[model samples]
Structures are given as structure tokens and as C-alpha cells.
Target chain A: MQALVIAAHGSHLNPDASDPTYAHADTVRETGAFDEVREAFWKEEPHFREVIRTLESDEVFVVPLFISEGYFTEQVIPRELRLEEWDPEKWDSDGTDASQATLEATDVGKTIHYCGPVGTHDAMTDVIVQRAESVTEDPNVGEGVGLAVVGHGTERNENSAKAVEYHTERIREQDRFDEVEALFMDEEPEVDDVTEFFESEDVVVVPLFIADGYHTQEDIPEDMGLTEDYRLGWNVPADVDGHRIWYAGAVGTEDLMADVILERAADAGADLGDAIERVRAATAAGTGDEPRSEPEPGAGAGD
Target chain B: MSESTSDLEALLAAADDGVAFDGLRLEHEGDGYALETPDIERTGLDEGALRDALETVPAYVSNWQYWQREIRGDGTARRAFLRRCERAPLADDESADHQPVADDVALSVPERYDALANGIDREWGQLCITVRFVDVENPDGERVYDLWHVDDAGNDLADLEVYDDPRDARALATEDEDGRYRPLKTAPTLRSGWAFTGLSGQELVDAVEFFYPATVANWHRELHGELDVDHWLETAERQTGIYDVIDELPREAVDWMAEACCVDSQCLRRREWQYEEGDDLEVDGGDGAFPCREPCSLVVAAARKWTVLESEEERTYELELTTSELNQLTDLIDAVAEGRTDEVREADVYDGANRYRARYLRAKRFDEDGNLEATERDGE
Candidate 1:
């Protein structure tokens, strides 16, 4: 079985935008679970259309390294890769139906199992929780801390905002923090209104983006007055009103997501249990032979 | 200096209209002297209070003399004086002595200019004046001052006339239109057209510093390399309404799309746009339209799926399947897709078979209801 991760590449103007995706892919490739683990991109090389042509595996599992199940997953991925025939009318309003559910292969000789985008998985909430905790000055006590899940909401699509709200609820259910609010860059209950949303003095804002790109690195920080500098992860100490605000890197960049990717592959019939155990055993033995694959010569190393 | 009644009358007689002493008088009080401008009727000061006010007369006279000297030499000081006159009476605590040296006075203009002033105000915007220094060589080098309209913000909004004579620049500095100080420019540089003419370099820079503070701050930031390309790009993006939606996509997808087609499809000019395999997607040919301005159908579809995944509400479905039954179900899916339905039937006896059968039944019901067009089409 082979694993193929698809992502949107960073812009030429801003190279660091796609760094997290490449970093995550490199981490997953080191696990040696699949015969091959290669990443394809929509904006960079190798292009998605050409990526499949390069594949040698008869059975492949494709996982979208996306934050949501938006236009890309339902339309673009299926159409480009010819994974499945998607008819909006055939499925329920939620776009999920038993007949159309997971791991259905196409008629071609290749068996491709497409998994849900990494962002929507139940385990992703844990990643968000971890991100919030990592940046919080005091993680043990969430009494005064506010968790703000910020997303790029659009008037073009209500689903975009809904996805953010979904994650907000999941993180809120953990009951770890005093408050959890879903905020957006372009919509109401906006990022600018974060100060009003939280009564707590310490607010941890985790961008619900898949990659630490422009919105995460530039827009969010500028809006929050976290820093004028644009980079990934924790910004310099910042505040809104009198509340201390901590900014985390995008939720998708977390290392635990490698595990989630493997789990998704497992659900798609990749059977990673043995390979994971092998990798774990190698790590436990301190063998220093952790099967980390060297990137292809032309594959750009993220900064 | 102390003077008798005759000396006071003589000083008042010599004062002209410009001195602002039309109805002035002086009166002696207990152990002090009272001097009144526009008379005691307007001032409404009692004899004892007027005596105390007389002591401040020396300081006020000295301040007025100093201001006259400064205003004569400094165009900015003159403008400040004129601005103060246009407004109401200066508050007792608020005086020319207390005003800070305008920011532009401290800024050293490039050596090319004989005089320049850049003033910035958050409320009123920016003002700038620059006079070019020219050296003409004959037998002796002759210095010439030519005032040029240079938009320091790079925004050509100031309607300024180039002046060969320094007097013209100075005259324009003090010029007033409609009772307000003219040449007070407003942002974002496209809308401003006011240009103050006659001012000394210090005054011009000071006016600019006073008028458009943010522009000066931005200039300072740029000069120090504190304003990075990303910051500028972000600012440009915000102003132009060019959202960073590309960043919202996965990094790999961004790279692939950049290689495959123009990621910016909104500006595509062609009626029926198609991304040719080897076509250059990066170049927009100055039209803001890349070869493909919008994502390809594939990317759009995938993005839709991603959105759905992101927005979809979570619901837990618990299933109790034995190891063998789970394996069988997994196997059956592959077998069915591979057209090995016989193998699927063989696994029908598994513990999860009833659940799987129920799904098939539900699907059959949907199919009978004419709701499963995709399934029906696939079967055909």
C-alpha cells in the first residue's frame, strides 16, 4: 500500500506558507508504513495530475492535507484523481451516505482509498487542545485562559464558517479552558471582536488553518497586535485590552497529525499497525535506523 | 520698565493697528500698575487682580518679540502663528513658547534640496515643501533655489507650481484660502491637492511632519528596514482586496496548482480558458490575470470537499464488530469493487453481515425510489 498526501503549495512570493505541509509529509514518510509516501501539490510541483502518473503502487491511499471538506475534497480531488464519481444530489445534505462512505476504489487497476481531510477528524480536536495548551503560560489551570479558534470565514461559503464553529464546539466540550470562541478573519464574531468574546485575561488563539501561511503568519497576528513580524508559531508577547494573548502555529502543523494521517490511512485499509509497531520498536531500541526517507532531489526543503 | 503717566500715553500713541492696542490703557493700583488691552470693560478685572496681571506683562512682551523674530525667519513658525489666528484665542496655558519644535524641523532633507519640510497630522493628513538647490558655474559658482513639487509620499496629489524665486515659495507658505491655512493635504495621497508655496525648509518639513504623522512613521519604518516585504505585501493585499486564499490551501496543493495552472482564475481573459500542460501560469501579462486566475475544476472540487469536511458536524457512530467480521467487511468492500461479488457473498455469513445487508437493503430502497441515479448509472 502507498500513501499519497495532497496539499496546496506556498506562493512564490511567500515560500514559508507551505513549510508545515512539507514538514508533516517528511515526518510521515519516515514511518516506513507504506511502500511509498509521496506528497503532491496543487500549486507547486509535482502537480496533482502528474503525481498520479508517477505512482507505481497498484493500491494507494490518498489523504488531503486540508483543514476542511470543502470544494477541494468533494470536487477537485475526485475530478483530478478520478477517485470517485461525486453527485451532490445522491448524498445526504451533509454529503455523507452509507453507500458513498469510505474506501471505495475506482474501476481502474489501481485501488485508491480516499480518506477525510485531516482537519475534520475527531482526533484533530486533540491537536487543537494540545496547540492551545502548548502556548498557554499556565496549562494546568485554565481558570482565566480563553481558547479562541480562529478560521478564515467567507461569505462565499457558509460551510467555511461552520467548520470553524464545529471545531470550536469540540474544543469547548473538553471543558479545559474558561472560554472557547470561534472567530473568523472575514466574518462576524470576528477576530477583532476576540476581546469582547472572552472574559478571561489570558487568551490563547489557535489558527484553525491547515498551514501556517499568510492568514496565520500575517493577517491574524496583525489583527491581534501580536507582532508586526510574520512567522509561524508563538508570536512575541501580546495583549488585547488588558488580556494577554498567545498565538499558536496552525493546528495542522502539530506532530501528532502524523499519527492522525496514519490512522486515516489505516481506515482506508493501509493496515499501518505492523509498520507503526516496527517504527516504535526501532525508536525504543535507539537503533538510529528510523527509516527516514531522504526527500527527492528537487523536492524543496521547507525553511 | 517703570514709566510715568506721560510715558505710558506716548507709548500708546506710537502703537499702530498691527500692534493690537486700539483700546489699551494703564492704571495705577495698590503697590502695582495695571495695563489693559481693549480696556477694562472687556477684561472685567478688578483693581487688585489687574495689579497682579501687570507683572506678567514683561514676559508676554518678550514672548511676542521672540515670536516676531522667529516668524520672520521661519516659514513654519509664521504658518503656526497664522493657524493660531484663524482659530480662537490661545488658552492662557497654551502659548507659542510651549509648542514643541515640529518634527520636520529635526529631519534632515536630502542634500539636493535647499529647503524642505514634511509635516504630518493624524487628523488632517500630510504636507510637504521642497526647494531644489542648483549651482550654475560661470566665472564664480552661482547658487540658485528652484522650488519643485515633490510628493514625498510618492503620491502626486499636491498641485504645486515650480518657483524659480525663493520669495514665491515663502509667499505660498503663508497663503490662506477660504480663511483656513491652504496646502494642508489629506490621504491616501490620491485625494490631496493642497500645496503650501512659500516656506523655509524647516517650516515645510515641519508642516509635513505635523500633518501626516502616519506617513512619516511609515517612512521611518521603511528607511530602517523595519517594514519587511511581507508587511508591505499584506498592506497591499488588504488595500487591493486581494485576499490570501491561496494560503488557505495545503502547501503541496499550492505548489502543484502553481505548476499546473494559474491559481488566479478570476482575471482570466479567455472565454473558454483551459490550462495547457506547458503553459506558463505565473505570468499575468500585466493584466492581473494569470494564464489561469482561478483554480482548475479539480482544485475547486477538492476545495469544496475540504470545506465540507471542515464545516461538517461531528457525530459518533459506535459499531461492535468482531475482528473477523471487521476483516470480512473490509474484504467484502474490495471484492465488490473488484467485481468479485461471489467473494462478498461468501463473507455474508460473518457477524457484521446483517448490518452490511441492512445497508444494501437501504440502498436498494433508495434505488427503487429513483434517488440513486449515480448507483443506477454505474450498474448500467
Candidate 2:
């Protein structure tokens, strides 16, 4: 049996940090592409250390649902998952090749294929462009508007900025928008500088982060001087210094992310052929179970 | 084969005609086995199919089988606790003693299980377990559960934040409603207004673990007679860094530590570890569903501070106090120790812990520097 595991950075203080990962897992499960789909977190229960033990499948494919290929994807994830031993001194150091898409290892008689994070996927350029375009109903949303891709860049790891720059360069090459610039939360050209970086009267800032948590929902918007009141998701275009700014939600929450995750799994050479055959055989035998359903009670509606 | 598997095989054998066990009914039908539950029934099942069916009969079996085998073995505290949540058949008079939070004893087995769709809420520590079916209308469907803070049990799912991932429950457990960080996740101060809805059996157990780490596992171990409790002395000896000084704490001080941190109001876990091996503390270990295997880090940290304070030589200072004032001091200590300081109303001046009463005492007895007037440490 084949299983898909999405590894993410879950927050001990923010309930919404793992929302996109669970949503993507649910979407993947609906497709019946893998025998099982589970999510593991770095900071939460069923953590990387124990997620492998929870799976009954012989073949496990793990995809990091992060927006970068830095400390987490290269080091912490692998070490925590027991694919590599964590050297305490090496915590602050880096040596793993950032370009490697998949790392295959064998642990406890299971073939573990650790796929690259969804953030650095080539298709993310399209996700970012789609987020920017879908932020407003205005037909000329992308026309004459400068697009700023905001990432949670850090001075600790330069690779975090690389993924944002990659999408920025890719979008710039498309030449669909007037200008595409990359902004960071921690590094230079901060989110607060979005207005100064773009000379256009209208600018669309798309957060290149994973989930719509503190950074996307509060920090970035506050930095852009949009609203002090923290409301989730895309906001109405706010006027700042004669510039109309449209702040889109985090890119990872998009529906198309399910495709990107599958793409990354496939690119990692996860044996999808066997899973596809199993699903087909089950369907032919009329044994394919109905899609899992959740109870809808008179209580509260979930996000 | 494992004992449980053998027991299952025996159960299948005993079902040659018809037998009901743990809300499941099975019988022989034309060389095949027929299985039935209160909500759903299936016939024409061979041996393998019978086991598969037993593994998943929707209303109870499938949801119960995995967790029963994985997280809960027979006779485990967690198994008993989960059984209690589902209002599973009582084995003896002992189980009948602790009534369900929402008593449905009048309802039949099927009626009780069916009512799960509306959710039967039960409290475990600060967690509220809502046991309900995934699809009440579907016979072949399994049960799904939700875990929320007890305070959020009756709140609308819309009013409280809803979560499906077990990992997300950590955020709900890490702080109070006011957002003050809770150093002890097991403290009764678990923040309300968040629900982990629509969880499968394993997901429910996993979410509980996130909310109160190792609670289910420890409970399971305790029930299986495998809980290895490290007493206060051993736990203190194992401590390193600045915490190593905790081992020097006086024996009576350990009793105070247990009183302050291990009781039901302070922590949800019953203290299994004692002052030393088999030397139980004078204080009650609490009535929690799970057992704490050792003094938690908070206990150790607090013990370290207490150890240093205990090292100070005894100091005596005479102070005149009215009989009422002396009684008030006892009441104040009891209020603080029982964590009812906030519960005592400020307007109720008769209460010793009342804000105004406490302020008056401080003004009368405490010097300008806030030290007790006319008293000094012997060393000073």
C-alpha cells in the first residue's frame, strides 16, 4: 500500500497554521490516488518522529507543505522524521543540497520518499499569478498593476528568499503584469516598503507564505497600513498614499495546491502507478467506498 | 496469535446461532455469518468477511476496533474511559457508580448509539468529548467524535473555532481564553472556544494526546499494569542544570509540592508517583482519569524554588492579631491553594480572599515595602 504524508510547521499558538495542509490532504484523499493520506507536524502531535509509525503502508511519500527549501525542508524535517540523525551543532549550519527534489531512505522496512516542499514547485508561479488576479472582480486586475510577492524571509537562511525570487523572476518573464517585485517580512524590501517599491497607482501584494495565519492575516496587512482590525482572507483594496493596494490571501491556501502536491509527489518518483491500479481495481470490483462524509450538526460551522 | 485475536475467534465460534457482545450482534446465516448493529445489519459474510465486518460495522465496530487494538488494550483506563463516553454496556456494579454526564440509561443500546448523531457530550479533564455518528442516516457509516474545551461544549460550532487536524488542538491547549500562556497543558485552565470536529476514532485519541500530551498512552499503560512511576525523589535526582537542587527538598516539602501541583484543581492527571518509591504523599493524588507517571517539569521547577526557600533557617517574629484576623489568614491560604481566589467575589467582603478584604489586611499588616510589619529574617 502507498501513503502520502504532508509534513508542515504546525503552531502551538495558532489554530489555523495547519489548515491548508489538512485541506490539501482531504482533497488528495478524495482523489483516491493513495491508499492513505495523513498530515504530520513539526510542532504538533503525530509529529515527524511518530508519523511514520502511524502509517500501515509499506511505501510512504512525504511532501513538505512549506513555502521554502531552507532549514525545515533540508534539515529539521529529515532529522525529526529520523531520515537523518540530528547533530546539535549542525542546527545552525547548513550543508544539504537545496536543489534536491526528493530524498529516498529505508526505515523500519518502509520505503520513505521525502519530496520537496510545495513552495519551491515551478507551478507556484501560476498559483501566485492566479492569487493576484483572483483578488478582485475588476476585469483589469492585472493590467498596469505592480505585483509584490511577500515571503517570510530570514537572515538565518538565504534560501527562504530564493523561492520568492524564483516566483518573482518567473512571473516577470511572463510579462503579464507591469512589474513583479519580491518583498520579505524579515529581510530588506520589507512588506512596509511595498508602496515605495512600486511606482504604479495600483499594486497587488500576494503573500507567498503557506497558510493564512499571523503573517498573511495580520502582519503583512498591518505593514502595508491596510487595517488594524484583523480580518481573515483577502481584503477590499485599501488606499495608501494615493496607491490602491489589494492584499491577497496566502498562496498555499489555493485549491490548485492539491495539484501542486501531487505533482511534487509524482516528481519525487512516488510509485503512483500501483496506487492508480489499486484504485481502478477497487472501482471495477464495485468496492470503492463512498467518499468520507462529515456530520453537519446544529452546532457551529467549521472553517 | 494475540489474546484479543483469539478472543475474537472464540466470539465468532460462539456466534454459531446468535450472540450479542459490546453492542454488536452476530449469527450464522447459510454457512456465512450475519452481523448486525443497532443502526446497520449485514448478512452473507464468510470468515474473512466476518472479521472485516467486525472490524467495521459503522455504528460501533470499525471505529472501536482500530483504537481498541492500537491505542487501547483490554482493561486499559482509556478503553474504560472511551467505553464510558459511548455508554457501553456496564460490566459490573462498579462502572454503574459513576453516571454518564448526560445519563441515557433509559435509552436502549441502539437508542443510545443513535442519539450520538446529536452528540453525547462528556468531560475528561478540561476536554469535552462529543461522541456521535459520522452519518446518522447511513447504516454502514461509522462514528466520528469531536473534542473541545468543556466550557465550549454547548457553544455553537460557529461561535468557536473549528479544527479537523489533531495537531491544531495544541494551540487550543497552550493558552487560556485571555491568551495567557499556560506552562502546564494539563492545568484546568485549558482555553475554551475551539473544537476539533468530525474526528475518526484514532484522530480523537490523537487530538486528546495533543491537548494533554501522553494522557491516553499513560492511561493505557496504567490499566495494563505497565505504568512505571518515577517518584518525586527519583525524578528530582534525574534533573540537571539549575533543577538538580530540587533533590535536596525536605520530605514534607514534597507533600506540599503534591498538594500545590498534583491535585484535581491544579492538574488533571492523578499523581501516581509519590514522594519516594511506595511512600505516598499525605495529600490526595486526585481523581483524574489518567495517571501522571512522574513529577512533570513544572513540578520539578517549582520544587527547585521551594527547595531553596526551605534551605532558609526558621525565622520567628511575634505579631499581635485578632482571632478573626487569624481565622481570615487561614481562609485566605485555603482560597489561594484551592485556586478559588478569582471565584471569591470582591463585593462579598466576608470572604477572606475578597480583593478589598485582602487589601485591608495588606494595609494593616504589611509595611510600606510590602513586607510583613515588625518582622525580619533571622539571618538579616
Q: TM-score each candidate.
A: 0.41, 0.56
For model 1 the local lDDT of residue B135 reads 24
lDDT of 2 by residue, A1-303 (tens): 788989988765666677788777776776677876877876554466556645557778888898876767776677656664433233232322232333344344467777767888876776677677567644245668899998888776677788888889988998778889999998898988789999888898889888888778888888788876666433478888888898887988875577667767777676554333222222221223221111222222111
Query: How does candidate 2 fare on TM-score?
Result: 0.56
Model 1 interface DockQ:
0.01
lDDT tens digits, residues A135-222, model 1?
A: 6534353666888988888765566676678878976776878999999999888897778888988888888887776677778887
Best by DockQ: 2
Put down candidate 1 lDDT per residue, B61-91, tens digits, no spaces. 3223323333323222223322222221222
- Give the per-residue Cα lDDT of candidate 1 at B349: 45
Runs of candidate 1 with Cα error greater than 4 angstroms are: A9-12, A88-108, A137-141, A228-235, A274-303, B1-380
Candidate 2, residue B199: Cα displacement in angstroms equals: 10
Model 1 TM-score relative to the real fold: 0.41
**In candidate 2, residue B224 scores what lDDT?**
45
Tell me the tens digit of each residue's lDDT in model 2 across B163-203: 89886775676667667766566888887778888887667
